[model samples]
Target: MSTEAEYVRIDDGVLEITLSTAAKGTSLDFAGVAAGTAALAELGADIGAVLLTGAGPNFCAGGDIRDFAAAQDRSAHLYQLADTLHIFVRALDSAPVPVVAAVHGWAAGAGMSLVCAADIAVGGPGTRLRPAYPGVGLSPDGGMSWTLPRLVGAAKAREILLTDAVLDAAEAQRLGILARLTENDEAVLDNARALARTLARGPRASYTSIRALLSRSATATLGEQLDAERDAIGAAAGSPTGREGVDAFLAKRAPDYSGLN
Candidate 1:
């Protein structure tokens, strides 16, 4: 069958999720939401890593305003949209494997939020991210309020949201929103793929555990976080991969993580 709102393909242990509505600049609607969520869930079933990107120059241009205009109550409509976005963001945040976003061109509003939700993000040097909510006479949604502050602190996040400023890849990197910045879209995808490969070959359980810990640590108290770390360590130590890692260190050889399954 032809791809739906977008396309999802898995190869070489990596799942590549692409936004396919290039004519619309990948603008999201309810159909896009359903398709994207299903694609991501399917990709997570077997893949060791996921790479999210767009098929055209723009990663995404945020919600399709035309769809928004069709709703009866704009406030309720926006809340529904935010709820849909939360489902997708939570899936990415809780995925068992690493997620890398390969950003190019414009990543605005919810698109930027998606990039932030990824475990690692690489952007093209020419890529631009805009907090476009205020510009459109709307407030931030799709976990932007939560993720942005964590990445750049409250002051900078407030400035971005209040002004709806567009940030270049270099500025995004400086603010800790982007993991790496490259000269072109291909380079950004290449770097993300390389990083995903490395993560895929590492201790999968340990990586998942650490991902959970770090994502939750932001709002946790120091003592609560310490307890979480202790619990996570104990759980990891009980895993077969952990034993293999210990044996490898003592034997002076690389761990056979393929046996983790």
Candidate 2:
């Protein structure tokens, strides 16, 4: 784990993934992205949930423009980078456990896409989000086009991309981009972690099944969705954990779920 990019630490059931380079507003570059991906992969097996947040005042300020300028062929380089980013985003979206983004300050460009990829997002009252691609004469990449439309609808996504306007945390929450907003960054991260802890303690298999069903609902027909739901429910009901939960309820005792005797 390089000190340049913050390393992820898994404790109990939660994976705390913090962004380094806070002094630079936690700017995202190739190094940061690589580090993040590695951390997620390393912590995936042990951690039941992930809490993504920045270290300092800002969450992330998009890409490192200096690194971009140094690329020999900007177009080709960017395309390759975009492909890597897509892999990372899709992994986050489809993770067995949930990933929560805790946004404190600026979340722009790729940073905003990262937030959108999370299963849930929380932001501080003063957090700012923006689609800043057009401002730099570059088109959107890094799953922004796919995620923004799904999050805020095509019309609003178009407006934000075309105008590149800044939106506060409350506005983002109202628009459904953020699940909740807190008074400050610390509070935002704490609340997100609390939620993650709760989710981590719940029925893990059922949670993953629900996530898969909902994620595919947009493309699946109503009948297909119904069938999927039925299948998922049946599977959950047959699991030992679910059976234990039911038995515990009937017995008026707490369910033992520590995966140990």
Candidate 3:
């Protein structure tokens, strides 16, 4: 059997997902969702965070143009491709744990969308991002249109999508597209993994609730946001882990989250 497009391995509390075919620009294939979805399904509730990174120099160069030409009917093939890709996007969005992206090289097209969807992203000095869609006479997909505007505002998102502008890591950081830059020479994957490890020891339920709150905030009205926060916090307060967190704080000790050492 051919190797899967991605590989997932959990060590400690971090689920590390690496794009195995970096030479192919980490372009996600039609079947890529199966491996990724299966991996997320295997993550027990106790797991802390999911870390995503490409295997080689470039992050993901987007879909394969050659493959696009190979498809006998481009319209139907693209629809099928997007359908599979949406599953991966939904998995990331609905995952109880936070997703940390380590972006390097070129995060083009859908690859850039993956970065935008991340809860936190760490990039390096050499990292570069481009919206490679317009160049091919295609439009954005993989939730890029939705998430990019939220990060960089509507006008800037339009610029990035419409023009063939390339955003360097520093520029991406300034625009709030990248959370922050690793050291000039630091390995982005290592930095992201370290961050995820720290998060892995945090209170799981609270983190999950935090993601849910953030997700809803994108579309919720002010009153709705407040209500969601109220209900979520209330539920968390009644959880065993939440009670232990409170007790630990009052007792003047570290909060020993459910699986924390």
- lDDT, candidates in the order shown: 0.80, 0.78, 0.83
lDDT of 3: 0.83
- Model 1, range 1-261, lDDT digits (tens) per residue? 345534666676777777435766577544555666776777543578878777676777788787788888988988887898888787777787889888878888888888888888888878889988887798877789989999999999999989898999899999999988887766877788788777777888888888889988888999999999999998788889889999999999989888484
Better of 1 and 2 by lDDT: 1
- Arrange candidates by lDDT, descending: 3, 1, 2
- In model 3, what is the error at residue 171, expressed in angstroms? 1.3
Q: Considering summed lDDT, which 10 consecutive residues are worst modelled in model 1?
A: 1-10
Q: Which stretches in model 3 have alpha-carbon errors above 4 Å?
A: 4-6, 23-25, 29-32
Q: Model 2: per-residue lDDT, tens digit, 1-261?
A: 456335566666887666535655577655556666777666544567877777677777887777678999998887887888776676677677888888888998888988888888989878899888988888887788888898999999999989998998888999899998887667877888888887777666767887899799979999999999999889777787778788889999987655620
Segments of candidate 1 deviating more than 4 angstroms: 1-6, 29-32, 39-45, 70-73
Q: Give me candidate 1's TM-score against the actual structure.
A: 0.90
Residues 108-227, candidate 3: write the lDDT tens digits. 888898899899989999999998899999999889999999999999999889896899998999999899798863578788889999889888788888998988898899999999
Q: Which stretches of candidate 2 lie over 4 Å from their true place?
A: 1-5, 42-45, 252-255
Q: Which has the greatest lDDT? A: 3
CA lDDT for candidate 1: 0.80
Can you give the TM-score per candidate against the true fold? Answer: 0.90, 0.90, 0.93
